[model samples]
Target: MKKIIFSVLFLGVIIVLLMQTELGQMLRSGNIQEVAANIQSYGWVAFFIAIAAVVIQTFFPVIPFVLLAGANVLAFGLWVGFGVSWFAAVMAALANFALARYAARDWAEKKMGHHSFVKNLNRHAETKGFIIILLARWIPVLPSSAINTAAGISKIPFKWFLLATLLGKIPAVFFESVLGHYMINWEAHKGKLVLIGIGLVVFMLGINYVKKKKKSTLLS
Candidate 1:
């Protein structure tokens, strides 16, 4: 607990310092295009940094993954950016899983014991582990870190977890990459961007509605 708290505080201090830098200022501005352009100026090093950022954010949960995905697309184009983002997400998930299972074992166990949702996930993991993980990954609003932690503490096989993560991340990463690409190039593809945005909104709404219905049914 002391180590985790210290690490978080240390990270917070680093973030505060970074926010004072020009690059961090750009990030804080939330201009994805400008941030991507700046990061791209560093060439190949930026790719490694981007991946590291994804992994770090998995533990920290400070940076918005969506913005990072968009920045990758702007920096590396559609295909390469999609590949990088997808791979990074996978790596991050695996890292978090390992952390929960090993480094944060006590924390993971405590979280599982305290959270009813996590307990439910653990129960489902005993049987339909892959499906439970797949749905959590497929649904953007679901807390990915918590799910990863819960899965790590459960009896689910690592192979199933890996397979489900790989399969589930494809569409989400693709959506982020395409949407980001089009959004950055909006002047040339305004109509397509609008359609994509509308489609995404509808999809999210439908998912939320289904979740609400499921919750209500369970309560009843």
Candidate 2:
């Protein structure tokens, strides 16, 4: 309880600071391109700041991460952008998992018991936790924070969590970086980008469908 309170207070302070600062103002402007341009202006320091921003956003979650991923791609291009975004996202996810497991364990457990989606995750954690984590990462609709928190609260091993997170994030982050890259250069690769986007969507949906069917079969 004390830990949770302290964490909340700390987060509150950070939020207040951000809202009063230039960073907060830029975020409030809702201009991804502008933010990207500003980050790019910082030169090499931009990569470090971008990584820190990703980690911070995971905790605060006020900013849409897709915007950050896009900004990284805009500043660093395809390969480097993907690498940075993927690494930062993995780090952020691990941080969230650790925070939930340590600082917020009791609260997270109680909350998971109350929420249906999280409840289901708790069940899967007892069995195929890795697959659950992997699938959750791929499905954009499934909240990543919830999965991280729930995994921490459940009996899933840290190794499985880490492995699943490392693998699961690949496709999603790659897709985000690639899409952003193409979007910026849309005039040249508009058709190819659209096809890639469709293919990714279809692939994710197919994997999700298969997983659901497998689950249903086991239950039956």
Candidate 3:
């Protein structure tokens, strides 16, 4: 407990220190281009900084993830940015899960046990855990921290959570990466970007339809 508190405090101190710099100004402004320029100024260490930013944001979430994604895409291009963002996000999810499961599950249960959603999560975790996590990651409307915490406190196996998170995060991460790149160079990729956006909307609609049908069947 003391260790966790200390680590959090240490991270807080680091953030405060970083906030005093010009890079921090860029980050506070939420200017993707400026953030990318700051990242580029660091050369090879830029990747490390980017990954750390993603991981930290998963826990603290003071910075918007989309901003980080956009900055990464502008700094590293689409594919590399996608790879880095996806990897960092997955790692962060795993960390959040581990922290919740190993460190805080008992406490969380005592606190969140009264919530209907947590109760439902507990009930279905063993049976529909993978699908639940997959959909949550795929849709991304749910908070990533919430999903990780819920999965941790529930009966889902680590392997199932890992697989679902890995598979489900792909499309969203890729789309975000593409969106980030297009934001910078939209004039060049306008047609392709529009098609991708349409495809994503159609895919999300199909998933929603399936989910609704499944729910109705369950109710019946």
Candidate 4:
């Protein structure tokens, strides 16, 4: 527990320092224009840095994925940006899962054991992990880190996780890329974005309701 607290505090200090830099200010502002310009300044190195940013954000998501994806779109254009975001996100998810499953599964299980949600997830993972992962991936509001860590400690097979992640991440990444591209002009897309957000919330609520109903029926 002391080690964990120290690590978190250490990370916090690093973030504070980074925020003082110009690049860090741009990142903190989440101004896609400034971020894209910064990436472009590095020339070809931009690709590597952009991909690395996506990967790193998996473990430390202080940087919003939408911002990164948007910056990629501005720097690399629509299709290439979508490709980069999707590929990097998928790879990042796998890496996070592997780290948890191989290095920290036992520790994480012990820590989260008393949590009812974790127990329920473990039970579902034994039977419906693939579908759960797939749907979870589709919900951009859900934290990818949570999904990856939970799956890593569950009984779900790696292959199933990979396949489901691959299928689920495609549309989600594409949508994010597109959203980022248009978000450059918030006023231009404000109405559409609002509608989309409302729709997503409703869709998630409906999914939850259906899931609960199905579980109740099965129990009865």
Top candidate, metric lDDT = 2
How high is the lDDT of residue 116 in model 2?
A: 66
For each of the candidates, the C-alpha root-mean-square deviation to the true structure, in angstroms, is 3.9, 2.9, 3.2, 4.0
In model 3, which residue pairs have backbone atoms overlapping below 3 Å?
none
lDDT for model 2, please. 0.79
CA deviation > 4 Å runs, candidate 1: 1-29, 183-194, 208-220
In the range 163-210, model 3's lDDT, one tens digit per residue, is 998998888788777776776677998998889779878987898899
Clashing pairs in 2: none
The digit string of per-residue lDDT tens for model 1 on 172-213 reads 888877776776677998999888779868989998899899
lDDT of each: 0.77, 0.79, 0.78, 0.78
Positional deviation of residue 107's Cα in model 1 after best superposition, in angstroms? 2.1
In model 3, the Cα lDDT at residue 32 comes to 73
Per-residue lDDT for 10-67 in model 4, tens only?
4465465455555566766767788788878888887776776676566666668887
Instruction: Give one digit per residue, the lDDT tens place, for model 2 in 1-220.
Output: 7787877876675576457755556666666677678778888998876786677677776667777787788878878888899999998889778877888777777777577656676677757889988878988766778788878877788999999999999998887777766665679888988798798789778877998999999999
| lDDT (Cα) of model 3 | 0.78
Best by TM-score: 2
How high is the lDDT of residue 169 in model 4?
91
TM-score-best of 1 and 2: 2
lDDT (Cα, 0-100) at 211 in candidate 2: 81
